[model samples]
Target: MTLAIERPVGVFGRKDLPDDWAHEQVTYFQDPETGLRAIVAIHDTTLGPALGGTRFYPYEDESVALTDVLRLSQGMTYKSAVAGLPLGGGKAVILGDPATMKTQALLEAYGRFVQTLGGRYITAGDVGTNSDDLDVIGRVTEHVVGRNVAAGGSGDSAPMTALGVFQAMRAGARAVWGVPSLAGRTVGVEGVGKVGYQLIDLLIADGASVVAGDVNSSALERVVHDFRGVRTTGSIIDLDVDIYAPCAMGAILTGGAVVDIRAKLICGAANNQLAHPAVERQLADRGITWVPDYVANGGGIIQVAGERESAAMDQVRARVEKIFDTTVEVLDTAKREGMLAGAAADTVAEARISSSRARRTSPCTR
Candidate 1:
């Protein structure tokens, strides 16, 4: 399922960004005619062209959008590196409410901006965007992925992402309880959105008790209706569960939240789960097995990346299931070095990036 994607020769070279920025490129585009305001941040391209999703949200201001894109793009860099993919990291954010401002023309305008990058950035869907939106963008540029399967691109990535999280949860269970099963454990899931919904489905099938909480009542109701005997809770983090799954937005594991979490293991689909890196040390001190967010949530990216290369669905599924191995390796590394899991993951990913950098700059190649 893992196919080689060759990086374009000389397409990117290491350079310090403006203001000593660590990112490779940051672009801000505005289309007055279509009422589009967007930011695209390409953090690294040592492995290949930067690939990530476009998130459409109504930010309070451009500054907030900039912060989100930078953090997310950087996270993508680490995610791809640790997943052993030959892709780099980048992300885009459209500054508008999807419900009110999402139009075909607006998306096309965004696509045109993406086209300007000329393949240095490849985009898909995130947050408010979906496969349908990617189809619209595809009409403008060839650099889009994760479109509808009927449209010759991979469909929704949520299910594959959930599968990866389930595998990670199994790995974490093994590390903590000496078994790789969630058969009799209780899991508290925060966020029953696309990824969370499918994750709950898997956990239920594995015979694990599930209690979920979501801000959207309809999403929670849909889970209740579709699955029998599933419980709904007011606060997922406060529950006395064996595992806590934050499948929603990022920074759910803040300092205060980590102190109150009753779960023995923390593994979920959310990115940037820790509000700060120091929180990982807190979780470690508390004896909670916190699987790094990027390590646990690499499934969606792997699925979409395979779709970009025309890999079959079966192959993609097999690749995603390997999250179990990656998680176990990371946990083992952390324990052996007496470091937090997140720090250990960062060490592993950074080593890969550094090695790639060395290869790219070697005079023997030139």
Candidate 2:
């Protein structure tokens, strides 16, 4: 099989790096034998070691992969900070289609690449990767989380992530409608994959009128079969619903799209929901309560971090539930300070990160 591999060569100074190269470190690994090309980016480690999932995808080229990893890694740092977790942000991206190119040797080779970083970066599961993939990566590296529960790791993070988003939705309801309940509300969910399916379950249980859609027909079918009364729509964003939850890919809420959003609230498990910073202001001007994506979907990282700390399941759930309070805080701050929700979230998260850095550098009071 011929692989469209592009090995990034030459030394890149800070000036030569991409515009989004605000990361602490960015390393590329290529194993010609196993046809494995990966990029691991560490954005920060002020609180502790960088922890994030490894995304495996078939990108068009190296530039796209770099951009994705940079954005995702930075988002993780903010996610952990807002969630009050003691983790920094990092991410890994494998440059190939998992379906056609994944193999034991390739995963193991990637694991070895992770091992070279020592304990500075921890690997988990993201899109196109799962607990089983973590299991394979764990074979060659100790710095892996979100492995199967049977394998003594945190297992899948999707359920926890969905739970966090659900809580965020509840908080959104409180902020906008003055009620902390989803009952009698109509929520439009985009993407019924791992996290979205479980979120639909929670919404259904809470008596919310659910209108869901997914690009994957099988995923849509599973939700339709499992949940009665869940209406499926071809266009979730355009649906006349109280809340629009984006659980699939990122940047769905672009400038043009925000103008047409009928939903009063936007809360979802997807990262980087706003394509540009300007979109945050647009949502605010439209009077839509937008839960910052990282703050809303941080439960998965909290779960994996708990597993790393050897915390119990109850502990993890409690931490995940705190997303509700965080959501409330971010919204309240945004309203009070006359700032956009995304800006408010960044303020809150950056405060925590900045405090950590201060404590680390300050001389000890002996």
Candidate 3:
């Protein structure tokens, strides 16, 4: 759905998503004192309240942030539903460079704005934000998750995200190679940050040879130091590996990148991996097995979702492990229907949400 927001003088430009979009709710806020200009989009709440993370990042314009948050929130809606979480999708994006603009006061200001939503949108750590930042947000509002363990919340969902992706990679291997193992497989990881590093750890532990790269030299250096003998040829994106894990930003699979991909499987933690619908067709035409990003990288939301029900970590982790089965099923459905795996996964989540909506009517009306 298309949404237009009137911007105040000197604020970021009018809010707009990259593509034509429709959403349940889109709210805009600006706090000049804290440099907090934000957009929160609630894609759906048919199953439950809109739950997702707050991503802090630098954007060239407000429209860019709007587009990112809208897509991300919608993905969270599908991610939660596919993962069997009793929650809907929503996301908030703060427009600023987190590296330079982050402060306790700013986080608290953002939390206060979130409090205005009255828990319809749950905020967590994403991109440039973390649990430490969530703790600050939590201090101001009760509608925050992924807080520090000292505060009685699950901390650092990157490991769980990685675990789920690792399981998803196994499912991809099964779909493409007729085996559920990454051992002896050469995988190229394009981004060795929080989730990427943890995924690298899992690959190493599982006896897979990993070739990792990152924009951050320090992060790449750490991966090289931690996992010795790992290859880093020219660009990580150009590696001719069996599996390509894009544990970074999205849109790598679109345009010429789709033609350049030499991997048999594409799976990673990046959101919005497919730049457009036709890109999915491109990957399918090339005989690549792609695990939907939302389906494969849903462990973080599963962890934070457990907090709402006061579930234990073991139970949460077990729930996260179910991604393996979901990934395999989505791939199977895609193959049978001749559709993209992402579309198949979205159908599963949409069906669940639709069923819930259908059940909402009163018996008296019927």
Candidate 4:
């Protein structure tokens, strides 16, 4: 029982939060043999159902994990609402390096914890988790999404996320450069993982030259082999390109990276892109158009919340296209009102949340 788990309750003032937030269900799992710890945080269910992803990382403290789950869950709520999906927000964190600590027993333990929610929170892949990990979680709870293709799930959330990012990039490009196509534009992509690799492929397909970087040598090699106009680098942030796509972990655009970025548009599937609120303003001052992370990377959740798996591809593409429209609208409004892009997106999402809450509580609806 660390103070981090108790901190959210204190800040939200148990009585002031939504009924579901008061409970703030969190399940912890510890494997005696492997000495591994994991926690799942379910935030609210005011919308329809709780949906989020399981991320594995080596967090320095329990508080970090707690804060991540809380913020990510809340972001999911805003993301779902803005994306026009009928889902709530939740997140699971495994406190270890996935490369070494992930085991079948550990995944099963995590799955059982998800089961404790009794279908309230659905789990998917994030950060260190992948379709293979989702398959393991699927063993315990059917509430898992992004499973392997053979398992009847959309194993490729990266492409859908990349699609959304590309769409947002196009909107930003149109607004700033007044270009209808990404052709002849140089885009730098960070973290050539599943999502980044797929995004690079899409960008190259659309006639955009790509410069990418990742710690994974194999992924970088694959990028080199697949596309001819691709360049690989050691550092992600230093690449001088038109658009900087951060498909890796969150908070990469911090104090230094923001200053070093040569891109005109900042958009990617990475959640919580800004290390601090001031960074958004920094981006704005630099004339770097930013597509809010939650609004831009919401296609994965939209695809999962739907009922039919067969039509998930079409729905994801459509939602990604919608993300472009939303980004353009938000950017335009932000420019007109002298506000930041993140603030504009937040305003739109918060309005939706407030309206949805009112509708849910209305006497006629009740």
Q: State TM-scores per candidate.
A: 0.93, 0.94, 0.93, 0.89
Candidate 1, 1-366: lDDT as tens digits: 001112222223322112333788899999999899999999899989999999999987776677677778888999999999989999999999999999999999999999999999999888999999999999989999999988889999999999999999999999999999999999999999889999999999999999999988999899999989899976799789999999987878877887798899999998778776678778888989999889988899999999878999999999999999999999999999988788788888989989998988999877
| Model 2 Cα lDDT, one tens digit per residue, 56-82 | 998888887876787788888888898
lDDT of each: 0.88, 0.88, 0.85, 0.78
Report the C-alpha lDDT of model 3 over 124-216, residue by residue, as the tens digit.
888999999999999989999899999878898999999999999999999999999999999999888899999998998888999988878
Q: Which stretches of candidate 3 lie over 4 Å from their true place?
A: 1-21, 362-366
- What global local distance difference test value does model 4 have? 0.78
For candidate 4, lDDT tens digit of each residue in 1-366?
A: 001122343324432233443435667778787656877777767776788888899987886776677667767877887787777778888898888989988888788777877888889989889998888878988788888888878785777877877888888888889975789898888888878888888788789988988888898999899878688897767567888888887778786778888888888878877876778878878888888888878777767665334665776678667888888888899989998888888788778767888998999998
Model 1 error, position 344 (Å):
1.2
- Give model 1's TM-score versus the native structure: 0.93
Once fitted onto the true fold, the runs of candidate 1 whose alpha carbons sit more than 4 angstroms away are 1-21
Question: In model 3, what is the error at residue 220, expressed in angstroms?
Answer: 0.6
RMSD of each: 5.9, 4.5, 3.7, 4.0
Pairs that collide, model 1:
none
Model 2: lowest-lDDT 10 consecutive positions: 1-10
